[model samples]
Target: MSLLDIDGVSVDLGRAPLTRVLDEVSLRLRAGEVVGVVGESGSGKTTLARSILRSVPVAAGSLRIDGRDVRGLRGGTLRAWRREGAVQYVFQDPLRSLDPGVRVVDSIAEGLRIARVPSEERTRRIAAALRDVGLDPELAGRLPGHLSGGQRQRAAIARALVMQPRLLLLDEPVSALDAASRDRIIRTLIALRDAHRERLGMLVISHDIGSLAALSDRLVVLYRGRIVEDGPTRQVVARPRHPYTRLLIASVPVIGVAGADRTERAALRAAIDA
Candidate 1:
């Protein structure tokens, strides 16, 4: 069974007119797979991520994790689900998600502490999480300000992994980094995926198709609030069926001479082609 299931889910943001921000969206992320959600700004990309976390209320349809319908869980039960670390969210800006004053290891350990994990065990898990994200275990003692942008992001990912979550929700995780840093972060994610014995389902929300192409098994193109395309990343990118999907492909900038070699063109082409 899939680790995360969101079926025909709809979300209303409570505007005066009460429009649906997510319109009957259905997606499944099985263990050991990554699905990327792509769209322009305000395409309800963030809303969909929140919907999985139950931070945004659903108006219709069902959402489930580990076969339990999250829509049916309320109050204490719902809060408990979030606290259980069945799922975790890695924010777009790692710096903002972390406190400058806090030690990197402490940031990762906070969840363990709240869950009342044994002090020794928490310390052990913190080091392992850091190593999983391709960081030196010793750096855990440094403050957020001491790390590079790429390192800080890795620390954020480490924090999520520390919870031992079955599913990871990554929102524009690499959108803020430079090409080098972005590549490093993506490599770390790939390593984490490979290192896990069980499939670690992931929902990566981003506008960067090229990066998503590198990481996702499937690509879901969202238009407005609807799912216009959902299929293997290669299939959808090579022969996009939806008009919105075509528009999105057409909108990507042509390769330029700066990095525009045959290699860049081919990589960009492979991102969409067979």
Candidate 2:
């Protein structure tokens, strides 16, 4: 059975006059797979993520995890779904989800605490989570404000990882950082996925093709609230079937071009493609 199944899902926001945010989106993510959803702003990528997490009410279709219908859950059942680490979310803005004053270890331990894990076990898991995200275990004692953006994001990833969820929903996880920091965070996520491939599946939502190209095994491109293309990561990026996908690939900055002439030509080509 698929670890995460989303079928013909649609989401409507507002009451009186509704706006369809997601439209008949269907996706299946298997255990250990990394799938990326890419689109421009307002393309319903985030809404789709929220739909999977059940933060938004689905207007149509069904959502399932491990063959269990998530929409049928309520109250304690829903809480149990989260507490048991069946699925976890790591948002785009790490600071929004991570408290500034809290110690790194404690922030990461919040989920475990809710699950009522013993203090001793929480400590061990916290350290392991930090290590899993490629951070020094000693750094857990520091406050959030003391860490670099990349470190803080890694800390955020650790917080989600500590839950030991089967699937992770990441909404632009590295889009908030500087170039160097973005690269570092992306590497950390890929390493985490590689290390726990058998037990973890991930859904990364981003407009950054490079980030998704590096981390995801498959890519699903969204345009105006619907999937325009879905295929293997390399295949889609290399030879895009949809025009939107082509625009995304053409936007990837070609690095290490030192000569002024080649750089100028490449820049012009990118501009033309755009």
Candidate 3:
């Protein structure tokens, strides 16, 4: 069975005539598989992620995690669902995700405390998670404000990993970082997935096609709140079938291009094609 299944899922913002942010989106992720959800801003990528976590209400269809219906859960059941660590989310901004007043170690340890993990085991797991993400254990006591952007992202990842989740939802998790820092974080994520094997599944949402191509096994392109293309990562990157997908892939800046010339030209061509 798939680890995560989203079927005909839709979200309406209840505006005039109800603005549908997501329209009958269906996706499935198997254990150990990494799926990339790629699209421009307002294409509902984050909305999809939020819906799965039950942070956003679904207007239609079903969302299931590990064979259980997410919509059926409530109160203690919902808490239990979270404690089971079936799904985890890493937001775009690590600084925003982490509490300004809390120490990094405590932030990483919060999940364990809520799950009632033993104190000793929690400490060991927290340290290991931080180390796995390429952060020094010594920095655990420092506040989020003290760490570099890369370190903060690593810490956010550590917070998710310490929960031992089966599925992870990454919503533009590296988009806010510098190129060097983004590269490091991407490598760390790939390494973590490799180390976990079939025990983990990931849904990576990003506008950066190059990064998505590097890390995803498959790619799904969302346009105007609907999936327009879905296929293997290599195939989608090399030969995009949908016009929007093609345009997005083409818009990626080539190395050595001065200023906005190449990208602007590509954008113009894409607009013409669209």
lDDT of 1 at 205: 96
Per-model RMSD to reference:
5.2, 4.0, 2.7
**Cα lDDT of all candidates, in order?**
0.85, 0.85, 0.86
Write model 1 residue lDDT over 1-274, tens digit each, in one string.
Answer: 8788888999998778998899999999888888999998988999999988888889999888888888898899988888899899999999776788999888889899889999989988888888888888777789999888888999999999989999999999999998899999988887777787385788999987778878888999987899989999888777878766665665554311233455555555465444
Q: Which one wins on TM-score? A: 3
Best by lDDT: 3
Q: Would you estimate the TM-scores of all the predictions? A: 0.90, 0.91, 0.92
Q: Candidate 3: where is the Cα deviation over 4 Å? A: 254-274
- Ten-residue region with minimum lDDT total, candidate 2: 254-263
Cα lDDT of candidate 2 equals: 0.85
Q: In model 2, state the lDDT of residue 153.
A: 86
* Clash count in backbone of candidate 1: 2
Query: Tens digits of per-residue lDDT for model 3 on 89-140?
Result: 9989887668978999899888889889999999889978987898988787
Please provide, for model 2 over 121-220, each residue's C-alpha lDDT reduced to its tens digit, 9 standing for 90 to 100: 8988888888888888777789988888888888888999988889999999888899999988888888888899888999999998878988899999
